[model samples]
Target: MFVGCHVSIRNGYLGAAKTAFAIGANSFQYFPKNPRSMGVKAFDAKDAEACRRFAQERGLVSIGHTSYPTNLAVDEEDMRERTVKHLRNDLEIAEACGSLGVVVHFGHAKGGEPLEGYKRMIRLLDELLHDWRGEAKILLENNAGQGSRMGTTIEELVQVRSLLAAPDRVGFCLDTCHAFASGLWRGSNWKEVAAHMRSSGYFSSLAAVHLNDSVYPSGSFRDRHAPVGRGEIGLEAFSEFLQTPELAEVPIILETPAPAIGGHREEILLVRKLADRQEGVFDLEK
Candidate 1:
């Protein structure tokens, strides 16, 4: 898998690529504009050009994610509209940059029936793809089941994908921390977890991964992310990550806690080592 991180793009898009190189990454994900406000920030033509050149020079892959608030399943009319605008902008930028995927959260139901939230998501995505020219596929990310958020199960994601009549343009970004917290890590259930997702037609639907350890328990449904291999979801889940064929061609991005708290380096190194070793490992998740 291509390894990377969720990086800050406030300085400029090129900064994201540069930071990836520092971490020995050949791939990365970044926001095209303010993540909270949906305020658009057009990159300098030369800056965008420079970003491409620099990443190409180092053989790096750049990916884009929409603002955190851009939720397709949000019930609030204003937020949903805002979500649509920001996602459209992200798709535009990602396409312009020739990025592979545009990562996005499925979003909270905002107190209504959660399934309806997914229906809303499907409707919105249909609109986005109606005229989208970009090659970048939309990668819907799973939540930790925090609050009213959707996407805790492969069923939910598969439901969303199915709504689009199983379109190949849609994809998934499986967050490891959320995977554990959603109960997929129960008693060394990696194979079951993998099977569930695959049965949902995930083999081709997944486009990337959010590699994180949990600061919560198995099935916590909480949204706290810990450094990799330093929390409840331990090495076993990660060992499965390397062997999972669906992720073999996807980008794996770290969403670990801040470096000052420690384990940032250790986490990266651990995943790199484990993924490289492949085929044989103990039950670290148990």
Candidate 2:
């Protein structure tokens, strides 16, 4: 199973891969640029190629995450242009580093209609992908239902994809915390969630899974993430969710809170153990 957590790219792409290896991870996610700022650091092509080779040699999966400031649903022309520019840069970096794709948040609607926001997002994305020739895709992430955020529901996400000019170049990244917080899943019945995703055609486009536990109760609409098995979502729910047949081959990325890399390592081991239980390969009690 491909499982890992978010790692820093401060050292470089190869450095990030090494960090994942140190933590017993076969996959990892990273921000292509400063997540809180608009500034992007230039990367050495040699280092990027080396990182790709290293990851390929070790069977590692690396996924890029777009900066948090990008808002595809923005009404302001300049801001929308800047968001597209940043996304283009991110895609370039991801392609260089041999990443699966970049995960993006469906930005907020604020004073605008949600449908309009969805259309705006689609239009902006069409502009972004129009002339771009890159192997990395754009993976939209589900929101936690906070305020006017788009993509809070699987149906809405599916609709957005249907409207996109290049639906084949765009996909999805599912976050367990967002699913619980948005009331899409109540920490029960993985089969039901899987069934819904299958019927909505979301399963076919699924690219990755953000394996997080929610810090708050279901339907809270909060985006707080907690370490696996240590929050409201609980361990039992996670174990069952890990065993879902549809998700078996999907890369699982941990966005859970961690004090340090060591904490992430522990969580990675725990997740592996949970997944292994399906084959009676490990006992949690031990």
Candidate 3:
């Protein structure tokens, strides 16, 4: 299994990989710029090349994520434009940094009609994909069902994927915290979730998993992410994810709270250990 965590980009675009390696991770994710800012930093070819080389030498897989504040489902024209522009930049950065894929959030619908909002999102994604020049695929992350967020359900994500012009190039990332908050499944019900995904043809498109523990009770609609095993999702829920045949090879990335330098080491080790055990069966009584 490819296991890792989200690392900071303060060092450099390539510095994320180094941080991942220091924590004994073989894969990782990072944003290209300040996650809360709209300003784009000019890409440096030299840094990109060095980061790409480092990943190649170590056989590490890299993933890029869009900033949290940008929303594709907003009614404001200026915000929508800014959202598209930044997402485009994110793809460019992902390509430059040799990332395999980039993960994005389906924007909240505000007071708008849900179906109409979904259609708008589809049109935006189509436009983006048509103009996309990068090789890295884009993966839409599941949300925590807060307010009027779209793509909180797997069905919604499936619909979005089906309507995209390049369905093969587009994919999905399941955030454990979001899933728990949405009441889709808890850690104990992973096997059932996997079965549903497989039968629904969504399993093949699974490119990444956000491995986070939740800070709220089940179905609380909270987005607070605690470190692995420290919150409601607990440690055992991860084992079910690791043992699932369909998800065994996908990259599992931790977005849990932790210190930048040495924060993710223990969690990374724990996930790796769980993956190695390959607990194929989930006994509910245990």
Tens-digit per-residue lDDT, 22-89, candidate 3: 88999999988888886666878788778889999998888988887876676777777777777888
lDDT of 3: 0.81
Per-residue lDDT, model 3, residue 56, is 93
User: Quick one: ranking by lDDT, best first?
Assistant: 2, 3, 1
- Model 2, residue pairs in steric clash: none
All candidates: CA RMSD in angstroms?
3.0, 2.1, 3.0
Q: Report the number of the highest-lDDT candidate.
A: 2
Q: Which stretches of candidate 3 lie over 4 Å from their true place?
A: 259-261, 278-286
Give all candidates' CA lDDT scores. 0.74, 0.87, 0.81
Candidate 1 per-residue C-alpha lDDT over 1-286 given as tens digits, one digit per residue, 9 for 90 to 100: 5777778876777777777788777778888777777865565667776787888788777778887667787667676666666777777777666577788877667775787877888877887677776678889888887787468778778777877843677888888888777776563788887787767787667778888888889888887888766787677667766777777677788888658644244456567777876543333444
Give the residue spans of candidate 2 off by over 4 A.
278-286
Residues forming the 10-long window of minimal summed lDDT in candidate 1 = 277-286
118-194 per-residue lDDT for model 2 (tens digits): 87898899999988788899999999998785678888889999898889889899999999999899988677988
Cα TM-score of candidate 3: 0.92
* TM-score (C-alpha, index-matched) for candidate 1: 0.89
Instruction: State residue 64's C-alpha deviation in candidate 2, in Å.
Output: 0.5
Cα displacement (Å) at residue 10, model 1: 4.0
